[model samples]
Target: MPRMKVLLISLAFVAIIGSLGAALYFMMKDSGDKPKSSHMARALAFRVGFSILLFVCILVAWKLGYLRPTGIPLQG
Candidate 1:
């Protein structure tokens, strides 16, 4: 990959993590011990955002060559 492309990809990954973290924080903060709907939404938002962050982290690691994937497959 070119230097410019790598830089752009890294920036994009960082942005994804930042935006998801902010959203999760706000969602949890806004939820109070009142409505069940709010609580559910908050929980869902946090989980989804967290998952996105994990994916972004993996992408970043792969881009920087810090993550190596093996061909081993595991069955659940």
Candidate 2:
């Protein structure tokens, strides 16, 4: 795997984890009876977007021949 691809994938994974952590934080910290849904929503949106981005990256890698399936053998 190329360094650039590895770096990008790792960063995307970190971003996704960060977004999830943020969402959990917002959910746990909002207890003042004020509307805190926005924060959580935003965090969730970020997580979803990052997940999609990661998926796209993987697809692109596969299409570009950077990624390939392994560890399975067909018993034809």
Q: Could you say which candidate leads in lDDT?
A: 2
- Residue 48 in model 2: shift from native, Å? 0.8
* Candidate 1 ranges with C-alpha deviation above 4 Å: 1-34, 72-76
lDDT of 2 by residue, 9-44 (tens): 888889999999999998899486556678889999
Weakest lDDT window of 10 consecutive positions for candidate 2: 30-39
Q: lDDT of each model, Cα atoms only?
A: 0.66, 0.87
Over the stretch 1-76, how does candidate 1's per-residue lDDT look in tens digits?
A: 4575568668766765665666566556754655645655665576577667767877897889866677788989
Per-residue lDDT for 76 in model 2? 88
Model 2 alpha-carbon drift over 4 Å, by segment:
31-35, 72-75
TM-scores for all candidates: the values are: 0.48, 0.78
Give the worst 10-residue stretch by lDDT in candidate 1.
Answer: 30-39
User: What's model 1's lDDT at 29?
Assistant: 70
